[model samples]
Target: MPSSSRSFDIAVVGAGICGLAHALAAARKGKRVVVIDRDAQANGASVRNFGFITVTGQQEGECWNRALRSRDIWAELSERAGIPILQRGLLTIARRPEARLVLEEFLATEMGRDCKLVEPSALSAYGDGLNGAAFAGALYSPHEVRVESREAIPLLAAYLEEQLGVTFLRQTVVHTAAPPRLDTNRGLIEAETIVVCPGDDFHTLHPERIAAYGLTRCKLHMMRARPARYDEKLPPVMSDLGLVRYLGYAERPAAAALRRRLEAEQGDQLANGIHLIVVRSADGSLVIGDSHHYAETPDPFAPESVDRLILDEYAEVFAGPLPEVSERWIGTYASAPDRLMLIDCPCDALRIVLITSGTGASTAFAIAEEVIGELYG
Candidate 1:
């Protein structure tokens, strides 16, 4: 059916996870929703990510709580949509004594209530191939879940359109979005409410409004590898690099000491914003990444040095020969210095939402529920 002639209760711009989340929220509320995006398929950060629905390492308070809620939604939706939950839980390795203190401190907090501290010798109980001798301890949190992003995005969209009856308009450029009517290259799309989830293209819908937040773009490197030997039992792996990157551990008082040690020992990794998050697919291939470099307009280049730094951290945690790098790519997301996300209101009927902290997979569903509750309730 042509969407131009039909009026919907809501129209969501963008087909990424954020947009799909809004579509699901509105449709569940019995709203006739149409989602419009410029791309013909799910691309951008949504598909390029590791699809890790992280809950344990998010910043404390709102971000952490939102992640918890979002993880539950992912579990529910995955089962309903027949999407595979490839892995569960997290292993945040503590590679130094200071890092161990940070994890111990984290375990004492409300966010870490359900998490436990894993000693070096006992770490293998969680999974094999962990370089335990290189670590002080580890933090195990059973709050995370992993999916193959490339596959799950399309599956989630299909479930929304087929089971929930949400309309999707791909390859449709929305020129002007001002609620009631979204002026698009295809045709005008009418709706009572509109939610725009522009991933990293801040200049598109409301440039001036988005500009007020001082948002920048963060470019990251990603890789797909086949390790010589990998334990299927291992949860997704992170390391000391993540303690400084993930706020749940970083914000603890003990993190200052850990950061100092990291600066002394891994300055290059810190300078490059390199962190380790290795998750596996059902086929035994690993999705690994990422380093953060922020700029208003990030370059399209994926440098070998950046990838080398990522692999350096990977080698310290996982044993056996280096994995065969089968594929590589780059991903970019919106970044704000002081906030994890933003919900900008241009009018009573329109909202512009962006996950500035690259946490869409971790927090999109919960954020969408909040927006929909405010818009409809």
Candidate 2:
């Protein structure tokens, strides 16, 4: 049925981080904005990701600059929205000699200035009872920040509505027919501009459009820890594993020799889909993971073998005993064959953006700025 409705300056589909970022950008411009999502609760990669607003491992050039800018935006929003900033820095453990060498070289570049290499003796000041064998030393980056995503997303949604006057249509499914009309369970919504931020549900919305970009699904396994039994003095952290995966670090001449060595040493683990990232919650409990597996259809079940592989790496990094697991889950996100993000205009006025590189929390704000500028400018 044809319906009567009010119009908005811009209609953003998907209330995840990307859509929220777009809504925030449009509202800051004083444009009337409405966000539509199929779920009554906003749950997806936006909430499922590590919530680590990372700057250290971002591919150099445009990606790194965007992450740096988004970090600034996150700081501002966390204050205005009254969301808690869980941690203020990043501690990247380097267990392998080759990994330590990589950090040595990475610090020589302009991107590495915000960080410093610290020996194990200095680590005692941050936390107690670390596993001695986990790392000889680690790189500490002062530029990153972390928030509890499960809590942060809801807080951001409320802030957008209460503070920014942005409207939200929840539990609504939008069909991208002519003029991009949304047929919600509530009613029909017609808008001039539509921006889709489908995280992993690419097939549900616009599979054909995304398929041309070689977009495939990538799955990660993660576990949440029970609150720490001891004091909470450590900062948000990741393993030096990414230094080998991200070309920005691997491509450096100084890092190349070390990269080749670690690859050869850990070749079996890499082939079996194992990597490590250990982040902590506000109460001191740690969230550790994960492994990467690419498939057309990713299983939601968290395999025990994969979980063990992640834990084995953890055992190698820390000398102390491993934390008892509290909860485990799998997260899937759209990834492009190319290492960069994909933002394409399927129509003159319709924009589809995917964070094909798992950098949504890190880079979404800057990406939204570019999208809105092109549309409203």
Candidates in order: C-alpha RMSD to true structure? 1.0, 2.3
What is candidate 1's lDDT per residue for 1-377, written digit by digit as tens? 55554688999999999999999889999999899999999889999999999999899999999999999999999899998999999999998999999999998889988899988989989989988988899999999999999999999999999999998899999999887888998888888899999999898799999999999999999999999889999999999999998998889999999899889999999999999999999999999989999999899999999999999999998888789999999999999989999999999999999999979999999999999999999
**Which candidate tops lDDT?**
1
Q: Which whole-number lDDT from 0 to 100 does residue 162 have in model 1?
A: 98
User: What TM-score does structure 2 among the candidates reach?
Assistant: 0.93
With candidate 2 superimposed using the best TM-score fit, by how many Å does residue 105's alpha carbon deviate from the native?
1.7
Q: What lDDT does candidate 1 reach at residue 233?
A: 97
lDDT of each: 0.93, 0.79
lDDT of 2: 0.79
Residue-wise C-alpha lDDT for candidate 2, range 237-313, written one tens digit per residue: 55656666666566666466666665777666576566677777877788887788898788777778888878877
User: Which residues of candidate 1, in runs, are more than 4 Å off?
Assistant: 2-5
